[model samples]
Target: MMEKAYAKINLILDIVGKRPDGYHELKSLMIPIDFYDELYFEPSDQVELISNVDIHNNAILKTVQLIKDTYHIQRGVKITLNKRIPLGAGLAGGSADISATIRGLNRLWGLNLPNRALTQLANALGSDTLFCLYNQRAVIYGRGDQISILPPGKPIQNITLVCPNIPVLTKDVFGVFEKAVAHDFEIVYNTYLVTKKESLLYNDLLEPAFKVSPKLKDIYNHLVSLGLKPHLSGSGSTCFLFDLTEDQKNLLKNIDDVTIIDTQEHQ
Candidate 1:
């Protein structure tokens, strides 16, 4: 069985408040992009994973163990992952993998677990894993487990992403995060609703992410210098721009030392 795990970008990220449980309450718009990782599964006597990239403290392993214990399954499987998503770029690569594993194993083992069960498993794995299970454009709330699928609007097109080679830790960024005022969130949200302008979108985590890594701030300023308005995705290291012209796309290609990803290009 093969499963595709699509990476996600947070177009709008707002920090509502810090919960007592240490997880910050968030309201963000998250969408899965065309870029993805592939996982191939084969039945085996023991659970084993082979991947193109080395992920420390892999959540996929935990997900597999969770499913086995939850369903009381004695069977094991060997999984091979062709990882394409860039790690720690504020893209939910790990969460996507976890969700894919859940789905892949469900089909492989014929568990027939319902959506609710899958969601429960996802929620336990991480904040963004639940969102990956659906892979739709949605507004996520309350530490990212609560998902509200937005009414279908125009599809996002000409999406270009600039991912710096550095990795930014989400926990590190959140640790130093300063919550934005409720008024700021209201204005940004309302403005985007009315205009559908990418520039109107806001990320409360940007300042904290910059604080965690000054180099990210430097990159942001550099993009601005080139007359581009880039919005930070999720926490840090990756910034995205929408509706770029052909000239702007070429300009991005000339940028040194950054990975450029374009989405929704027509053949």
Candidate 2:
């Protein structure tokens, strides 16, 4: 079976608090994108995993092991992965792939689990994994596990994502928020209302991220200079320009050493 794992972006994000478990509570409107990673699964006599990337912390293999350990099924499986989503871009690529694996393996093994059960398991893999299981626009809270179906709001603009070959640590991003704990619930909730208001919806992480990677500031400043208001996606590294026409897209294509991905709200 071949399955495609999609990417996600935080339309609006805020840090609510840090849980006792050390996980940060967040309020964010998350939307899935068409960017994907491919996974191929086949029934095997023994459980095994192989991948294109080295995968030192192999989520696919770990997911298979986790399912067996949790569900205690004696099924054999094999997974082959084709990774396209840029790593550490806050795009939830690994989580998406794991969700797809769970879905595909459940089907291949005749597990017949419901979406709710699958979501529960997805959470075990990662907080974002559950959203990928549902794979839709959602109001995300509680470590990204408490997901609520959002109103089918009017679609936003076409997006162009450019990852500046730098990895921004999500934990560090949340940690920064934890220490500061800006009481800007106004900024937090405005974006959730899903209107055309632009200013408050932007991420406050930009200041800290620019401090860490001046190159990120360089990329962001360039996008802004082009008359496009871009926001840092999730934690960092991947910045996006919204609502570009074909001519604008061609203009961005002229830039050197940029990874441009054409994206829209996943319908």
Candidate 3:
């Protein structure tokens, strides 16, 4: 079985507060993009993974073990991961892969588990994993596990994703993050629904991410100096902009040691 794990961007991310569990309460509008990683699964006696890049502290294996223990299935899986999404780009690549594993293993093992059951498994991983399981536009709340899947809004177009070589760990950013006054997400939410534009889009993590990696701040400044309005995806080193002109695209090509992906919101 093969699964495609899609990448995502946060159109609106607001950190509401820190919880007693050391997790932050947040509200966000997240959407998937065309960028993805591919995973192919086959039956095996022991769980195994082969990826183009070496993975340390892999969540894929953890997910495999969870499934085996929960279902008491003796069979194992060999997963071949074709990684495309850059790690630590605020793209939730890791969580997406974990969610993909859940879906792939369900079919591979013939568990016939419903979405709710799959969601239960995903919840153990993280809130991002839960969103990736559905891979749709939603208003994510409460540490990201509470999802309000929205009706298909206006499709986002002309997306240019700039992924820097720098990897900004989410934890590190959040460690330095200070809670900010919450935005009324309803306004941002309703405005996007009506206008199909992100004129009011914002990400609270940008400040902390910049603090975590000053070099990333430099990149953001450079993009801004080029007359581009770039938005940070999550706890990001990667930044994205919409509707770039050919000249603007050419200007972006001059940046060193960055991957530029031309994509759009996945419909």
Which predicted model would earn the best lDDT?
A: 3
- Best candidate according to TM-score: 3
Instruction: Put down candidate 1 lDDT per residue, 1-267, tens digits, no spaces.
Output: 899898888878888889999899998877788888999999999999999999998888899999999999999999999998889998889999999999999999999999999999999999999889988887899998898877646667778899998999999999998766554665776577668877668888899999998888988888898899999989878998887888987888877778999984111
Q: How many residue pairs clash in all the candidates, one count each?
A: 0, 0, 0
Alpha carbon lDDT at 236, candidate 2 = 78
Compared with the true structure, all predictions reach lDDT values of: 0.87, 0.79, 0.91
Predicted structure 2: lDDT: 0.79
The predicted structure with the larger lDDT, 2 or 3, is 3
RMSD to native, candidate 3: 1.0
lDDT of 3 by residue, 142-258 (tens): 998889898876778899999998889999999999866567888887787788675788999999999999989998999999999999999998899999999999999999878
Q: What's the distance in Å from true for residue 179, model 2? A: 6.3
lDDT score, residue 77, model 1?
Answer: 95
The CA-based lDDT of model 1 is what? Answer: 0.87
Inter-residue clash pairs, candidate 1: none
Error of 2 at 140 (Å): 0.4
